[model samples]
Target: MNNLPEDCIAKILSLTTPRDVCRLSAVSRIFSSAADSDDVWNHFLPSEFPAGFAAPEGLPTRKRLFFSLVDNPLLLLHDPPHLVSF
Candidate 1:
């Protein structure tokens, strides 16, 4: 797997679950870098995210953004009569 190109490795990792990716990172430095690649992590983010909406301030990379969303989901908006969820 280390012999493969980084893009190829990222593509393969992108198909895997987040838990699988974390385990794969333990295999080797190459896999660790591949697992942390934005190309791979971007697959875990919601498609609607950062599109019609903006991620809250301070979340840096795609990985951070993914975990942040999982840890604390965003509330789109709230009004007296209605509530919006994201």
Candidate 2:
């Protein structure tokens, strides 16, 4: 299982819940990296979640944002799904 491609693992994990992803992260280093990826969390986030949420463009930051939104969903409701400019 550890030998599987990171992105492939992420894709499989994406089909599972956040709890499952976190649990699997403890299985190995590869799992840890893939479990924390943006691709996996994007599946759990609201369908409208903007990819640009990674404004700081860091791996950890993107994971943190995912958890923040999960822990406090109101933020999703508070902002427009996408920002607009004139």
Candidate 3:
């Protein structure tokens, strides 16, 4: 790892899948920020579901539902209706 250049490391990390990135982030400080960068996030969002894969109606599960909601203003409205106090 010491021999790896920073750019090459970034590129390699960038190509890593999100789950791996999340796991790596816990390994060190530098890795945590690198994994959370806009470059990584931007790459992640679009790659999560391939082009033309539409969100299923009503989203059958919470993970799917959250992904669809994260970038949507309309779904923000749904949160108020489903709020559960801890």
- Top-scoring candidate (TM-score): 1
What are the per-residue Cα lDDT tens digits for candidate 1 across 33-65? Answer: 988897788899865444323445786567777
Question: Model 2 scores what on Cα lDDT?
Answer: 0.75
Where does model 3 exceed 4 Å of error?
A: 2-8, 47-86
Question: Considering summed lDDT, which 10 consecutive residues are worst modelled in model 1?
Answer: 76-85
Which tens-of-lDDT digit does each residue in 1-86 have in candidate 2?
A: 98889999999999999899999999999999998888898788777666666443343555676775555554444355643322
RMSD of each: 4.6, 4.8, 10.9
Per-residue accuracy of model 3 over 1-86 as CA lDDT, tens digit each = 63565455556777887678778778766776566565555555533333333446886433344455565523212333332222
Q: How accurate is candidate 3 locally (lDDT)?
A: 0.54
Q: Give me the displacement of residue 25 in model 2, in angstroms.
A: 0.4
Clash pairs, model 1 backbone:
none
Off by over 4 Å in 1: 51-57, 76-86
**TM-score of each predicted structure versus truth:** 0.76, 0.73, 0.45
Clashing pairs in 3: none
Prediction 2 TM-score vs. true: 0.73
